[model samples]
Target: MTDMPPLILWFRRDLRLADNPMLAEAAQTGCPLLPVFVLDPETESLGAAARWRLGEALVAFSQALAAKGLRLHLARGAAGEVLERLARATGASGLWWGRLYDAPAVARDSAVKARLRGLGIEAKSFPGHLLHEPFGIQTSGGGGYRVFTPFWNAIRARDPGPARPGPARLRGWDGDPGAGERLADWRLGQAMRRGAAVVARHALIGETAARDRLHDFLHGPVADYPARRDRLDRRACSGLSEPLAWGEIGPREIWHAARSVMEGAQDPGVDSGSDSGAAAFLRQLGWRDFAWHLLYHFPQMGARNWRAEWDAFPWRGDSAEAEAWRRGRTGEPVVDAAMRELYATGRMHNRARMIVASYLTKHLLTDWRLGLDWFADCLTDWDPAANALNWQWVAGSGPDAAPFFRIFNPQSQAQKFDPEGRYRDHWLKGVGADDFYAAAPLRWRLDPAAPPPVPLIGLAEGRARALAAWNAGKA
Candidate 1:
């Protein structure tokens, strides 16, 4: 409505068209907008697999937008520099985007905001990623909570409001690009050579697909989530992590959808079973929020252990044990399957994640950071906060930390949760053998072996060695 041309909606992590507060607010201005995605090369440093997933998400977003008469303007270089040039070329008055809490994102955003203001271009960030902003939830004494239960309790007591979907239509603005690497030229998936094919085989990306997946999970597995969530082989959990991580789906949307079913009952006068599944699923979302809170309050959490005592813990540095864990050859089927599954599909079941994390840290006595880095490189759904938080949890160094002695016995875990060996055989079969490297994804292929290497230390011995290392480090 104002004389200012539409603000450029600089798309980042919040990629979807629905339940996006920033996009909704920006659209209310009636300004013609430039939807832009900056493919900064710095992202390349994260991992080729991560970049590959990101590129696919973007391409899906671009195609969806194009169908609706809007095309995503892809650009590359430092974010600030790219935005400045974009502003100059498009004659745009401002930039707007959903906020991200990761350290790298925080650094880039701070610099970009200052530079945009300096250039007389308005820039604003909105809390479209997490339900409550990172700084929103805190303790009674006005400090961060270092434990999960208390932190989660604090969050549970609060209310996350209704979801806001994006505007149905936009009077899209034409924009000039200063520079951009062609999507194909970026070749984010070149390392895998079959990256897109791999992702397509398992996970589906994009708004509509995410919504459908959420609905499917709700109608079935969600009802039993509290009991079955940790089951590695069962479709016991929502496969929503990839979408949620990429912001292809927002927590707000998921929250409300699950709540609707849970709140509905044949007898409205009293509470019913409806709230159970919703409550359980919401708890996971709470954990996700808590992870972000930890990262925000303790910025060092992304890289350092939450517990200072654990800092003294000696960790195996890329040793054979570490290598064995990576190949799922730790003589632990559950752990190996998890690692192998991560390699094959760029994801792992939540239970599998914890199981493998425990094997790496408490069982193998390797640094949690090593496992976290590998996940960051390979996981299609890797969230900086969630990934780091969970790793530290298993290492007995995070908020509401797992006790060091609580090691996961992988065989028992598999027998209990994956009793049928369905998950194990699925991944193992995919690679032709338990240790077949020839057919394995290149990411999992270590040291040029014909078949993938098999397990080294038996489960019991690995556990003993890992615990001994922890005790030694403590002493």
Candidate 2:
């Protein structure tokens, strides 16, 4: 309506058009809108497997946009510079986007905001990625809660504003913007090769698929999430982690849908609000918030432990044992299966994460940071907050942590969770009894008679050593 050209909506983590505060704001501008997605070489240069999933998500998003006669413009380079160029090219008055909370993202956004302001272009951000902003929820003492329980308590006490509904309509700039690289030009799927091809054969990949998955879980697994989530063999887990990670589905929409159903008490048979299933599922969402809070408060948390003293603990780096665990070849069946699951599917179940993390840090006596790095590279859902916090939790070096002596017995974990051996069989041994276990990657292999490839360093020894280190400021 104004004499100036349209506003630029820079898409980052919030990839979908639904319930997005930023996109909603952009639509309100009523000016021509240039929806752009920048592939910052610094950030978008993720590992091969991550790229594969990203490409799929992008393709899905592109299709969604195309259906409405809109397109997501892709550009690659430093964010601030790329955005500045985009603004100039589009003759835009302002740039809009949702917030990102990571340290690197924060720094980048700050610079971009300053640059835009200098050019008299408004750079605005709204909340969409997280339910509660980092500073939104606070304790009685007027500070953020350090531990998760208190954090969650504060979160529940406060009302999250009603989620904005999905965008019902869209408008566009008259002139088409210049194109960036083709999706296939990025070659994100190169690393996984045959695995990527195979997974795509059966995987649903996009925003619509993500919504369907959410509905399916609500009707099925989520009803029993609390009781069966810890069981590795049960299909009770929602498997929505990756889609959530990819921003194919917004958390607010999920929250609203679940809460509405619970409030209605629509199905008396459903676990809904009354049982552990709904509560447990809600807790995972709480965890996502808690991790973001930690990252926001302690920016170094992404790279360092929450408890600083754990920094100096001795770690046997690149040892045969460590490599074995990395390669999914640890003689321990459960741990091996978990690593393979990660390698094959770009995700591992919640219980499996703890099992494998504990086996590496406590049993193998390796440093937790190394394991964290591996997960950072491997997990499709590798949120820095969740990955770092969960790793530190298992390593006994986090704010709320298990004691050093409480080691997980992988065998007991397998026996309890995979009682039917289905999980172990699926990845390690295969579909049937006749399917033999494949040879693990050459890095870490321990034959049954071999003495751990390194000494056992009994749990007691490891605990004593770890505790002493903790007391001595090196936990």
Candidate 3:
């Protein structure tokens, strides 16, 4: 090995080793590597379920590193300070990490880069977090695209290049890397309380698990994904969202894998519809990218309405109805089932998500932010951009949003998606219902035998009220 100083490889959401741009580049340097994970203010601000899931990711990642004869050093503090101190302590010459696009992360990373460069450290950010850089794709006017269809069209054919493989070998720093915090001391899951155990039963942790999930998806469910994805009672989805959220898997890897199936490189049985299913799955990935793109262009998406005119709309805040919605006692079978699914498993079906968001923002007339915050706290698969974008899409407050007047009738939706009521019955009266009760906090006093709640408002009345408010805002 060369006598060069160690290079500090900071880990963020990009936790996996395979197809990781930063790790691949660092391995090519032939210099000693110091892999570190800092629990800075930005990370500390994560919601309860997300935070708890993050801790599990870190554990699995650390174990993966150990198998590769490397260690993941843990630290807690402001990122710039902690990184600078670590660099000085380890005699490191450079710092590298994958990029994040949320407003807070963007602001913090910019400051960190500036501070590190001031000290003569080679600070760099890579593009593994997303298939493409958020700012890289643009419209003819050199501005970000406000609409998603055009954004998807722009990127659909353009190649993102091949996903890189993990380094064959890693050279670790030999000297004292300096003082580090224990992962247990952080207590990342403390906020999750009683629900952690329930959610854990559903999570597929680490990179290996993520890769296996992708393989399994491409080989089976993907064939029928296009037709059955919205069927709430069927296991027709990829189930990769939680892994994708924590960077246990990279988007490019998923993209290329799906593309391979689309190109017929892998036989997905005799299903001729597999091609269409793969295409549909790829579009969902594109939607994830689109969310980040919108967030990059409009940082206020999470907190404010994307359409300024939406400010005039009357959105009720915390009340009994909103609380009932949170507790999954809305009396709308589909809506309650969806909410309870979130409580028990820390994830909601995509169709269920849209229904519940529409019910809250349009039917219950509650602010979309309320639902957004609840999802943030409860969803293991929670992504900042996706969460904000989807909520706004349902609320008709964001770019390319569904019209506000298109309120979903929960009973009608239940009939269409959960036609057999298997999904509703599962969460409301079956095993899922038991999990929800076990997971619920004691203070909520949720009884397993309690009857379903009454409707917060009549569907027609709520729709009319929402339409009246929408019309008034237009006027």
Candidate 4:
């Protein structure tokens, strides 16, 4: 073993190697690299689905590191303490890591940096999780942009540069690394009730798999994205959200892929379709960037409304109706199908997400936080900034939020999007296959063997009530 002190690379959400900024920069330093991952409180507290996904991702990442002749040392406890102990034990010279946007993460990372600097061990953080650092963006007035259009326009216009390639091979610290906890002991999956078995089958892990999926979409399905992104019955989406959230893939990589298609670069992955489709799909990464932008500037959005005036807006506290909404028992075919899809596969279509969020916040008059937490528990791709921001956007409580006066009629939404009950037939078990095809032109074709759940509240009544509350608050 070499006597030289190693530079520690602490893995957090940015789990993958390729396109990882911290890994790339550290490799350039030519220091012996020691890889470590800490399962601290914030990580430990993730909802069941997220925890389950993280566990699977870690297993894949560990194997990926092993292939590079490296080990991802796992430790449990406060991250600062764990890193300090590990550094002292190993005679490490410094620590390097990627940044996280959430309030808790920022606090923890700041504290860790200060402590390490105090000890004269270098600690540096890099940007790998997002195309732009949340704090780096600002308006002409030097304040955060509360509007998304301008935010997107500004970020989209600026170049993010290319993603750095992962090291061809890593020089792992040739030292006596101490015992770190086995991944199995974490039990991140056991907290889940629907059984992580289902989510595991659905999740696509590892960086290579994520990159291949991006390439496949750029080649074939992306051309249809503009015309059919909201079609619930079709496979027009990239399905890269979870990997993006887990940092298995970077946004710059996806941005580059879509930009390549837009630029007329022909590859095996590009289908004969419109470049406009590729350009439209690239907006998703922009939205992800805007989510973090909002979170960093308005951290209170985590538990409160972005528009504080809406705080007094009445919401149904805890009730059987809310429980039904959460369980896919709301008797609304589109909403039920979406919730069930989330529970069974750990994901739902993007269109379905908006529909279900509308049903919970406006139709049932439930608080947006309930829907947000349930999603956090059920979605493999659960991202703090996006999930919170989107839930509030649908609830009419966030920046550039949908107007409270506007409500999605699930019946009409499914009709316009699902059209032929194709998506409903596959997911909604309430109706007999025959009845579903034969039912009225729109939703609820199924003759649920069990009586279709009665509507928790009449949509008209709920909509009217929500409007009254919102109007009163405004008045």
Candidate 5:
């Protein structure tokens, strides 16, 4: 090992080494690098699916490092304490990590940085997780972008540099790199129960898989992404959510690769936006950036309504109805199918997510938090900023929120989006019609011949009730 004090590359959400600004920075110092991942308190608090998938990713990450003649050390405890201990034991000089934006993470990182600095250690954070840091972009007024379009435009105005390549080798670790707890002992995957079996069939793990998936999508799916993304039955969207959430890939890599694809597709005669599908898909990524923008500005936005006035809006606390929603027995085909899809795969199509969130908040009149918490527990791709912002957006209680009065009629949504009812046919296969009606109120079971299931509340009735509650809250 080199006599120079090594730099500790602390791994968190930014898991991949490629396009990793910190790793690249640390490599330049020619100091040995010690990579470590800690299952700290905040990480422990992650919802079930998130934790399980994280454990799986950690193993993949370690292997990826090993292929390059390095080992990812694992430890468990408070991150600051664990890092301090590791730094002492490993003789590390400085620390580097990709930055995180959520409130809890900000607090944790701030404290750790301060502690390390006081001890004559250098602690630095870099950008890899997002192209534009949440707080970095601002409107002309120097405030967070509450509206997404302007946010996208403003960020686009700035020149985000080209993406960097992955490091060749990380030379460090005088002792055993696997000197911490065994991954199996963590038992993170055990949280999934039966859901694990279902999600495993669809999961794409690690950096290579992420890159391959992106390549495959750009080759074909991006050709039709603009019109096909909303089709729940179609695989037109980049199913990169899980990997993106776990930081197996970074946004800059995605952004540049997409730009390159579009540019390559353009012969001199073709316009830049000719690949409308790729452009539209990239806009969705902008939405992810928008989510962080809101969260960074309003840290409390996750657990509470962003439009605080909505706090007075009456939310029905019906455990039975909410339970039915959770179980995918709500008697609404589209809504039920979406919930079942989420349960079975720990993922829901974006359109399905909007429909169910709307149904939960507007039709059933439950708190958005209920649905948000449930998604947090179950979604393999569950992102804190995306999930929170979206739930609140659909609930009409977020920045630039959808109108609360614009309640989605599930049957109509299913007809329009899942025209053939293919989504329902797939997810609702084993679920009988009568089984759905059993969860509904007795009066709702009016059409036995039409379909065995009937809605728990009529759409018209639900709309009227929701509007009255909204008007009352405003008054």
Candidate 6:
């Protein structure tokens, strides 16, 4: 048995050990495992904030592996070439990894698998990133769903099964695998510049931290999620987006935990009122799945308009107004506060996200792709599928999108969601403002005491302009 070649485990977005199907199956083989992570071209192309966050996830995952008496070998280059070199060097006979659905990953993985198998090396991909396979659920016509409600109905009752527990012990491959790059040398956070330090203050890294967060949310705040999830002043929403984005926590674990609360199986302290909230929270998760489904079925979704007719609509490109919006100087209190929050914390409340996105697309009449690109660069919790889908949805450019006439009045939105102005004042004039200035690039020359800028366009004026354009485009 000692003479047997090792099996290579490639780590990508699925970084955790527990509830990880790939890791659990690999452990059952009782063979020495060579864990590796490759910084391939696809990964290198991630946005600055996402790249920096990946580095944090890698650090935490490395620590977790060390605790289990295993080592994660770091490599750089094209994934296929890197994996082949490591396999040849280590005499690895097989390789396994969790599957990813994004177009780039799918293409890369397919090519890698074909090339590796030509050498007679065993390669396998497992499903754990998403709750269900993207193509698994379909309409009666055997086609993918376009609307979310029917998609939600199709999957809401199906059980994803219990979460898998991590292996207690694992055998590591003996001897050095190959020459590897040090994580520090990679400088994944180089693009982040000064913003890294500020965002770190709000980040909850590592698998353990993610699990603890899930527990805390389910035990208390989840009960109010139904009513307060959109309230900017309340902490009623789960802060699991970052964890979920990095695969620090699997969705099935969250699903089961929430189910336990809903069924009164795990926590008796949760009142019956929580049932509605738990159910509502589950629907949000379904939305996450639906986003991926749309992405899988429509690979160009992130780059092109899902509805081809949208191409005819006139969308303004980059300009002074757009720059002001990005810098949180648009003079709209709620909008500025949200943008500032994104700069300071690498995250903005869900309601804030919609408001800012609406203000940019409908009020400023700017292209949605610009806002999407900015978010890709700024958000630590960025998911390619979700970001693109949500942007298109708000812009009324995608399937089942909101109507173009449905513009968000930021002032009215502030009154409804942030009535006391606590959310706005905190991010605009309080500690959040201080953090924003600290994180802002030195070149921006932002002043903490500066009064908010005057509104770029009047609400009614912008609304009329947008409607006229929309009507013209339709005609």
lDDT of each: 0.78, 0.74, 0.90, 0.84, 0.82, 0.90
4 versus 5: better lDDT goes to: 4
TM-scores for all candidates: the values are 0.92, 0.90, 0.97, 0.93, 0.93, 0.97
Q: Give the per-residue Cα lDDT of candidate 5 at 152.
A: 74
Taking the tens digit of each residue's C-alpha lDDT, what string does model 6 give over 115-183?
A: 889888999999888888898989999979999988887887788765797789888877678677899
Pairs of residues clashing in candidate 6: none
Clashing pairs in 2: 324-444
Per-residue C-alpha lDDT of model 4 across residues 1-475, encoded as one tens digit per residue: 5878889999988989888888988888888889999999989899988998999899989999999888889999999999999999988989999999889999999999999998889999999788888878899999899998788778775778678777887888989769989999998888764357655667788899999999899999988887899999999999999999899999888887787777784433223322367777877778898999899988878799998887888877767888888767797888887777787678889999999999888888899999999999889999999998999999998999999878999999999999997887676753323322332122323344676688777778878888887788888
Error of 3 at 250 (Å): 0.3
How many angstroms is residue 50 displaced in model 4 relative to the true structure, after the best TM-score fit?
0.4
Per-residue accuracy of model 5 over 1-475 as CA lDDT, tens digit each: 3566668889999888788888887877777778889999899998887888898899899998888777788899999999888887767788888998999999999999998998888899998888788888877889888998788777653545656888876776566443688888988977775456556766778999999999999899988887888898788899998999999988888888887787787622112333386677777888898998899899998998898788888887758889878877688888888887777677889999999999889888999999999999988888999999999999999998999989988888888889998888776764433333333234433344444356788888988888888888877
For residues 193-236, write the lDDT of model 1, one tens digit per residue. Answer: 65456555776688989999999988888778878887777778
Steric overlap count per candidate: 6, 1, 0, 7, 0, 0
The TM-score measured for candidate 3 stands at 0.97
Q: What's the distance in Å from true for residue 30, model 4?
A: 1.6
- Order of candidates by lDDT, top first? 3, 6, 4, 5, 1, 2
Those runs of model 5 whose alpha carbons end farther than 4 Å from true positions after fitting are 176-178, 267-275, 430-454
lDDT of 3 by residue, 1-475 (tens): 4377889998999889998999998999888888999999889989999999999999999998888778899999999999999888777899999999999998989998999999999999988888888899999889888888788888887787678877889987777777779999999999989899998998889999999999999999988898899999999999999999999999999998888887784544212323377888988898999999999999999999999888878999988999999999988999999999999899999999999999999888899999999999999999999999999999999999999989999999999888999999999999999999989989999877777787888999989999988888888
Under the 3 Å rule for N, CA and C atoms, how many clashes does model 1 have?
Answer: 6
- Candidate 4 local lDDT, residue 100: 92
